[model samples]
Target: MATTPLRVYGGVTGSDRQAERRALFIESGLELLGSPDGEAALTVRGVCRQAGLANRYFYESFTDRDELATAVYDHVVNEIATTALDAVAVVQEPERKVRTGLARIVRLIADDPRRGRLLFSPFLSGTPLVHRRTESTRLFTQLLGTQARQVYGMQGSTRLELLSGFLVGGLAQTLTTWLDGELDATEPEVVEWCAEIFLATSEFPQQPGRTSIHVPDGSEP
Candidate 1:
């Protein structure tokens, strides 16, 4: 009989084990970075200890704490983007589309307040997170621009880009404040207000077979 190659328990391969360890480290980073205590607690040794893994495993996955923090921020932002896009895609009515997307974003923070802290906390200033946040904002602005063209046949303009940037930035600050308990509104209220803002600012032209468009100048036909 031929001798079988030795394998780890449960036949887990080295690549699988490494991936598992990397996920553990990412989760640990999220816990540390997203907590109210903030990134000060996100040291490599601290994250490895939290994941119950040794420092060697952490190094195997991330070059340093900054890399790990960037990874965590990217992971959370990707999730939010996916969720909001999915929610918006299933709706055709303008108000419903806006409400669905905005509600998904709000629910993400409400479901895990830590994510809000991680994404929007002031503590993220002067770190790799700032770059990641900028990238995320650009991505979301593009998505909003695309949605505007699709839903309302609106052409891209400098003013539209500025408006989208403003909306994304304002929404981020609003959620950060609400998550930090500075805003006393309920989750539904937050979602509704955000939806209203999106609709009001869009200033889309009114047409048949379309939902009501609120023109800021009372120019709706």
Candidate 2:
């Protein structure tokens, strides 16, 4: 069978106009993913319609459907991480930072149901990079490990790894539930709930027994 030449929507024409069109094409693909009528089983044709481009245009920018999906996933991840990290930047205290980060993340997901669905859903199973469990695990582990060392004064790297692994599991499960529509709270309410969990739980561990300690200023031990 003869293959048709795929034209990518907003394909680069080496001109500003082409760049603008390509941006529009990418944005349109995300919009389609978020549309009320859109399902998780998205396609090149569907994205083309959403972007108002010819089906052939999809190939001009992407090699295949999997490539397109990877682009969409990268877009969503960058957007979410940038937004959430911005919210966390001003937080000075480690505990507050963790709380604010989680709240911001949950709020982001709640605010954009489509993005939440994309991040939490299984649609990326079609893509190789996005579907790798080991990669996902490593990323989450690093995030949580940093939080532990910075916030809790976790001494050893091994300890940080163990704690981070447990914390990431909780976070991933929580996000997956939020994405699956298992929670019915407002965004702020969700944020508050997430904050409470983060603050009181071992996920963002506080100093052990320090909560009950009373050290006198004039005494030297």
Candidate 3:
């Protein structure tokens, strides 16, 4: 009779387990931070409870509640950026591209209003998330500048950067207002208005003679 060898079940490795725990913490943070109750619900213990994770697991992945909050904020912003870019990439017409991208943003917020509140709510002011919001705006401004160059042949200029920042700031405020019930417009209307603003900015004349108006150094006109 031959002796059969016993098989060992080597389950998940330590690294794999840690990754799982980190992901759980991130998702839990998102829920707590994005809740209608807002950042008040985002304590470390609260997140661990939400994730059904031990406090030790939370510390293993994040230094503190602020770090986890930042991670959650970045996750949501990344999703918004990717979804908008992917929607625009498939279109050739400039108008359609703008419309598609803006519509995706509006629809995403509509689908999950929690994300809108998390990203844009004034209630998050003075929180670590305020820095994250500024970072997100900077990232979107860069994206807008790139899109202007690619779709409109508009080169980098001081004016273009200023306009990009202005548009990004305006858009953030508009969406925030809509999310907070301060704006009465429906989702489609909001999308259309944003697309119009974006297209108008993109169509600005870039002729050197026209746009190169002289300005005194370090002086505002």
Candidate 4:
């Protein structure tokens, strides 16, 4: 027997064709969400307008705006995670891995300040699915700690946790500032400076419980 087609708001279509339309809907939602005044409010009708689909098509993929918001957030987070992880994947040295990963993150933010703003928005910070950003940051922190353990024999989950949150939070705030128009530094310059600060803080030889690190001036990539 052939499988029945999935329905969006009770409208049915072939599975493959439905998936394509859903993708288009999601992409369009993201574009709208990343707009200059996007975070003010998002509605099903607004998203439908952006996606150029009938009101019914909005429900084909997402149950509501919150659902669509979650999907868009996930898409943005995945993009950042992939870029950072891929940077670390090709490096053999711990310092290089941290450097490249941090640089890649800065570059990603620089590539699209508006997208960065939405990705780092405080609105996405506390919700359940929205917490994926924090989870990803925690994972990166753990990865860095694991790397440090293998190389420097620095071992302690708490220490690593602190380091990870500190570094990721710092980077997040810095990128937020840039995206919010509070910074004047170029992307390359920002990334380079951040790498130095991050590596220095990450590898502080003796301080095992430090929570924050300082960024130095004149540090350019």
Pick by TM-score: which candidate is best?
Answer: 1
Candidate 2: worst 10 consecutive residues by lDDT? 201-210
Q: TM-score for candidate 1, please give it.
A: 0.86
After superposition, the stretches of candidate 2 with alpha carbons farther than 4 Å from their true spots are 1-15, 34-41, 129-137, 200-221
- TM-score ranking, high to low: 1, 3, 4, 2
Tens digits of lDDT, candidate 4, 175-203: 88877778999877787888888778655
What's the distance in Å from true for residue 123, model 2?
A: 5.3
Cα error, candidate 2, residue 104 (Å): 1.4
Q: Give the TM-score of each candidate.
A: 0.86, 0.70, 0.85, 0.77
- Candidate 2 lDDT, 106-160, residue by residue in tens: 7777777777666555544445535644465677678666666666666655656
Clash pairs detected, candidate 4? 8-60
lDDT of 1 at 194: 89
Error of 2 at 23 (Å): 2.9
Deviation from native of the Cα of residue 33 in model 4, angstroms: 1.8
The alpha-carbon deviation from the true structure for residue 129 of candidate 2, after best TM-score superposition, in angstroms, is: 6.5
Over 4 Å off in model 4, which ranges? 1-3, 6-13, 122-140, 143-156, 205-221
Query: 26 in model 2: Cα distance from truth in Å?
Result: 2.9
Residue 188 miss distance in model 4 (angstroms): 1.4
Better candidate number, 1 or 4, judged by TM-score = 1
Per-residue C-alpha lDDT of model 3 across residues 1-221, encoded as one tens digit per residue: 99654343377666678888899998888787778777889999899899998899898779988898888888899999999999999999989988998898888988888788888877777467888898999999999889888988889988889989999899889998888899999888998988888898876776435456676787665
Model 3 off-target regions past 4 Å? 1-11, 207-221
- Which residue window of length 10 is worst by lDDT in model 3? 3-12
